[model samples]
Target: MLKKGQFKNAVKMNNIEKYFGHTAALKGVNFGVGANEVVGLVGDNGAGKSTLIKIITGVFPPTNGEIYIRDKKVSLRNYNVKQAYKLGIEAVYQDKSLGEKQDLWRNFFIGRQITDRLGFIKVREEKEIARKIMFDMIGFRGVGISAESKANKLSGGERQGIAIGRAMYFDADLIILDEPTSALSLKEVQKVLNFVRKIKESGKACIYISHILSDVYEISDKLIILDRGKVVATIKKSEVTLKKLSEFMLKYAHAK
Candidate 1:
């Protein structure tokens, strides 16, 4: 059972709108993501998914309407990437936001870290944390690369593991993943899907934005279809058939 203020849904957008100069990107968009639930956001190339994510992450404020976290209405003004972290809202974009030359531990605690008494950086502590996070939080049990393996040296699947592990280590209540498995092989895609499922089992909400309907059906607990800056439907995973979801995505693509 979820408490009223606890926000089973970590994010709620009511009539969200975004305008760049004079062009409108989103118009009266509304959506919600529940706790421990994997909600799939499916649409064509320019269905306002990125805009919506930017709004939720405080990259930009909505031109109109309300945005809430844990049911508390909040202003997005002055809220930057760091603020988003404090709010327990983390976004893992398709571009893999890890430092290529930096090791896994360095990338994991790049922006945030624990320091020693004299304000010296604590490398050992960070590595320990990273190791624990990779194994416990993300269920990654692959090659025993020292925490010092460069991120670029990691394979596609391994890099993804590092990214997801970082997000989980931050104790993020809501994670927004944008095309996480877009560049991976079939086997690697399955590995990423397994990590997503683990995220839900750990009782955190995840918004998976993907163009792949099959992936969505395989891993999502709910589906939210967005078309031309508006939400077309929000359906339960059990209630939606793969054929129905594919049809919805196709219709949305054609409508755009």
Candidate 2:
């Protein structure tokens, strides 16, 4: 149960720290994602962005600090891969996480297959759900994709769209996207950005981890800049422009 009168942040980490032997990956990182905000996590390689996200996804627990989902504190000892899903935290990593040869429906329902009393997979219902999600939730109005559409046929951005759409359909409250727009054409990048907007529209929060500053600027309400495993800047979009953000990143990085 939530504590009385507490604010319900979508995801909150307080005094988070992670260390690998003597190497410190994160140092007392404090962050939060609001219930309907898009916060971009940006930094150069080895800036601890990935480490922070890994902790968020329950891939690893932080060595110290607290994690709260919607104002309720959760113990790291009981947080696992299954618990991550149960708590409505989902991650769409850079890999796009789809089987190349599998059709869209199969990819959507790969592991958590809906089974009947006879222990058989429900084929038609899954297909219909996948189709609705692609067209409605994902806004896939371009080249027609049916249940039989193979994953190999979609573009990088489209693959991301489907993966994100699947997350939304599962009613995930917080979705973490890792470099989702990497290596895509300008048009495709826009489509993926639109999908991120869709996520926000559905009253969900996101941690967008990316190297593309322009897309990050375009989509995120706030930017959290990290340098040397510490947060250097957390500025709203209204407070900083793309050029200024780029300059800030470089300036703080050089200070390290």
| Candidate 1 C-alpha lDDT tens digits along 33-68 | 876789999888788888889888888888998888
Ten contiguous residues minimizing lDDT sum, candidate 2: 1-10
Name the runs in model 2 displaced over 4 angstroms.
1-7, 253-256
> Tens-digit lDDT track for model 2 on 36-116?
889999988889998998888889999998999877898999987678888888999655489999998999888888889
* Each model's total of backbone clashes: 1, 0
Model 2 TM-score, 2 decimals: 0.93
Off by over 4 Å in 1: 1-5
lDDT of each: 0.83, 0.86
